[model samples]
Target: MVIFGGAGDLARRKLFPALYSLHRNQLIDQRFSVLGVGRSERSADEYREIVRDSINRYARVDVEDEEEWSSFVEKFDFVSLDVKTPAGYQRLREAVEERERRYTIPGNRLFYLAVAPELFGPVAARLKEGGLTESDGWKRLLIEKPFGRDYPSAEDLQAQIAGSFKEEEIYRIDHYLGKEMVQNIEVIRFANTLFENMWNNRYISNVQITASETVGVEDRASYYDRAGALRDMVQNHILQILMMVAMEPPSRLKPEAIHDEKVKVLRSLRRWRGDDVKRYMVRGQYTGGYLQEKEVPAYRDEENVPADSDNETFVAGKLYIDNFRWSGVPFYIRTGKRMEEKATEVVIQFKDVPKNLYFNKTNDLGPNLLVIKINPEEGLSLQINAKKPGTDNEVVPIVMDFCNNCQEESPEAYESLIHDALEGDRTFFTRWDEVSLAWKFVDPIRQAWDQEGADTLTFYEAGSNGPKEADALLIQDGFRWHSPYNPRTGSVVHGSPIGD
Candidate 1:
């Protein structure tokens, strides 16, 4: 495997750690070799030293094996070459050719772009131009998120890379799709007859996917300022999750089949335009406050961020999929930075009974909920009507639990994605149709927001749920977001931070 930008923070922090785990598990063998390519002046040994410290800190090591470490280090080598220069490409090509000859391994190169988004096109063009990827085994490219800022740019990016690699050969990855729980999303909804029966507009009242972050934008402030919460979080992550929940059942478990279904949902998304955008959407920014036992700075205080920036630190919106399965149902997605608690999960709110026999019985003890926990902690819990303890004809909500993470070892998102790439499994990768539909659907809200401007970018203090706007978003519909943190009890009328 040829890992581009191997010395960068992403490569060191996530890519190396995941690859090491793959090695330790014996999933990869001596036949496999990883070439770390970057624009750095470092020898093979020097690069190994850099990787050794990274693996030690990030890898989940077990069964102390010195020999294993030594053997893994043997695969750790580097080629100092920038993809920007022609000479650099030649040098990189020569180094990879030698490795191929030495190992007698098929050049099944997996070009992973671990660098910044701006460099994605250059590296791709150089790889194709240098003829480094022309060899016997399958060659593939795994590109990361922020596929594009919007519709036109995303389409342009697709066109630029299409010349170098075929659509099937190019693997566009969304890490959330690689997640253990996220993968099971398809199974949870389809494999089970119970979930399928109640997944329609009749039983489900509202669906909420909240991805909160407790930390502020300490780094990447420039990027966040331009994209904000909607472009960064909603356009990709939240929409993807919504598709997982609301997509129609596929006839087969094929990549095209899965992606086709998702695209349909994106097409069916509620059309928010003109004045309706502000009515359905809510946006906010964080004020200065404390989090994680320390005083932290606000968005303005962050480096690279403008003092008068109107970019939103938070966004909460309601999505109405105009389909038979989800006509009346509303999908709510709220994401923000530096609020209070750190967590991520999905809450499926079921419709209330025409006459609540339980409301009078349990003193309005909240409606029944079927929550699918995604991260920080991962699990499943369903609320059912039950009789109150030591009561006659009185009912309350009780939960039945299934925690997937407690007993099962969930593979990291990168592990699943990288392995899928190597095996040529496109089931987990996104298609252009999916990407285009997502951007097109989000474009209107984005345009509407940009047109009106942030006349009311409410500011929420740190260690609180988002601004009152987020609450009012759901309250207007006579529903509430279930606080996954306090699921054992119920939704907290109190505040909590953003994360996942």
Candidate 2:
């Protein structure tokens, strides 16, 4: 493995930890080795110390065995290089070759570009120029998100990289796709007779996908101010989750079949224009408030952010997949930073019964819901109406919840993705067609925001859910966001009664 930004935050926090976990689990053989490339000056031994520290800090398992720890770190080598220059590529190539020879490893290489988005194409081009892309074994390129600012820039980046790597050799990483619940979406739909029969507009009412965070832009103001919530979250992570939830079942469970089905979902997304943009989308910024009982700064007050910046910290919108299966069903999505708690979940609401036989007994019966919890907690919960134990005909909402992560810790997102890259499984990775169509679907909202300036941008308290307009977006359709069940309190937050 060749990591471009060896000393960067991502390498320290995610990549190294994931690699260490793979080693601890015996998933990779002794022939596995890593060549760290960066501009910072460091010897191989010094770089090993850095990896040791990161593993100890962020790895899932502890370093209990001294011999195993030493053996794993010994496989890492570091080389100083300014990747933008051709001369640096020569040094990188030499380092990679020396490590492969010393370890008696094969020529397979996984090039991980953890640097800035602008460097993605240039680094690949340099690798090809230096004869590093050719090998006796296989080669792959793994890229991070924010693929481009919009459709045009993304297309240009794709063109530049296409000169060196083919579409199949490129792995576009959307970490959300690596989550356990996200992968289970396909199984829950195709493997179950109950869900597969009603997974359409006829029996389903609406779908809600949410990814909220309580942390503001701590150190990424420069990037967040420019990318905002739309490009940062909606264009990649949220949209990818939407695809998994709404895609048609593939003919087979292979990568190509899955990718084709996902692409169809993106192609069917409703395109928003002129007046539709304002009517369907709501954007907001956060103001100072208390989170977890501690005071926090507003988005504008954050470091490196302009006082009057119009960039959206929160966005809520409605989308539709204009296919026969989901013609009238609305897919509502919202994501933001510094608001409420951290969670990423999908809510599938089933339609109410045609006639209410027990309406006179109790009108509190809630709509049946299938909630898929993704982050911080991994579980599935189904809400249904049931008779109270002691009452004659009293009806109330009851939950059948199953917690998947309560027994043992699951693999991190990076761990699963890195293993797949090594084994050449593109099942979870996004293809070029998916990325291009995602950008095309989101470009209009971005352009509309640019033209309107900050006039349409609203504000919400940092610790609150979001702007009131966000709720109105759903309420106007006679629907509401179903808050997830809170395990700590044994209740749901802001839960509305059925038929509200």
Candidate 3:
């Protein structure tokens, strides 16, 4: 494994920790080695110590065995390589070759780009020029997100990477798809007879997917300001989850077959332009307010953010998939930083029964709902109506819950993603066409925001459930956002039930 940004935060906080856990579990082979490329000058022993500290600090599992730690560190090698010039690439090549020969292992190489997006093309070109991809064994390139800001930029990056590697050789990582519950979307829909039969417009009324964060962007202000909520969250994570919920079941569970189904969802999205952008999308920036009983600064007041910046920290939109399965159903997506609670969930609100036989007119029983909890917890629950105990012909909301948080610990998303990439399982990774189509669907909205909707930046208090206009986006359609503000309560709080 060759990591381009070996000393960066992601390498220390996530990448190295996941690798250490993999090694601790004996999943990584003894013949496998890692060559870290960066501009820092450090001895192999020094780099090993850095990795040791990182593992101790961030690894989910214990790395306390002295002999095991020593064995793991022996595989670590570092080379100082300035990506700007070709000379450093030659040195990197030598380091990899030496490790391959010393370990007596076949030259199966996995090059991971954990650096900024701007350097993706330059590094790939240099790797090719230095003969890194000409190995006798299989070679794969694993790239991190920010896969271009929009459609054109993504295509340009794709062309540049395609110059050195084939489509099969590339793996674009979206760690959310690696979550256990997200992977279960296929199982819940396909494996279960009850859900598979009703997973369409007929039985489903609206689907709401929410990924809200309680913490503000502290160090990531610069990047977040430019990317905003739409490009940062909607274009990748939210849309990927949407596909998992809306896609047709694949003929077989192969990578290509899954990709085909997901791509179809993207292509089926109703294109929004002109007034549709304003009508269907709501953008907002956070203002200074309380979060978790403590006050926090607004988005504009954060470091590196312009005082008058209209960059959106929150996005809520209604997407309609113009297909037979989901023709009139709306897929509502909402994401933000510095919101009420840290949660990632999907709510499938089934249509209500026509006849209210058990409840009075004023106390109308709600529709049945299926909630898939993804983060801060992992589980599924179904909402049903039941007779109120000791009451005469009264129906009340009741829940059937499956709590995934009962376990002590679950594997991090990065762990699964890295493992799949090593084993050549592309089921959870996004393909080129999927990325392109997502960008195509997202570009017009972004362009409209830049041109006319910039002033549409409404302000919501920190730690709140976004601006009220988000509620209106759904209220107009006779629906509402499903708020899991307190997942521990096991209650699905609709937007109307919670007032400011």
For model 2, where is the 10-residue window of minimal lDDT?
491-500
Q: Write the per-residue lDDT of candidate 1 for residues 237-296, one digit (tens) a residue.
A: 888888888899997988888888998998899878878878888889998888877888
Predicted structure 1: clash tally: 7
lDDT of 2 by residue, 1-500 (tens): 99999878899999999999989888887898898889989998899989988988898899999998889998888889899899988878888888888888788889999999999999989999999998898889999987989999999999999999999899999999888889889998899999999999999989999999999999999999999999999999999999999999899889999999999999999999778989999999999999999999989999999998999999999999999999999999999999788999999988876554655334445788988989878888888878889998777788888777888888999999999999899999999999999999889999998999998799999999999999998888877887887554567433543354
Question: What lDDT does candidate 2 reach at residue 319?
Answer: 94
The CA root-mean-square deviation of candidate 1, after full C-alpha superposition on the true structure, stands at 3.4
Full-model lDDT, candidate 2? 0.90
Task: Report how far residue 94 has shifted in candidate 1, in Å.
Answer: 1.7
Candidate 1's C-alpha runs over 4 A off are 356-365, 407-409, 485-500
Give Cα-based local distance difference scores for all models: 0.81, 0.90, 0.88
User: For candidate 2, what is the TM-score?
Assistant: 0.98
* TM-score of every candidate: 0.94, 0.98, 0.97
Instruction: Choose the strongest candidate by TM-score.
Output: 2
Name the lDDT value of residue 166 in candidate 2. Answer: 92
Candidate 1: which pairs clash? 212-498, 212-499, 213-498, 213-499, 339-463, 340-497, 341-497
Off by over 4 Å in 2: 359-362, 492-494, 497-500
Better of 1 and 2 by lDDT: 2
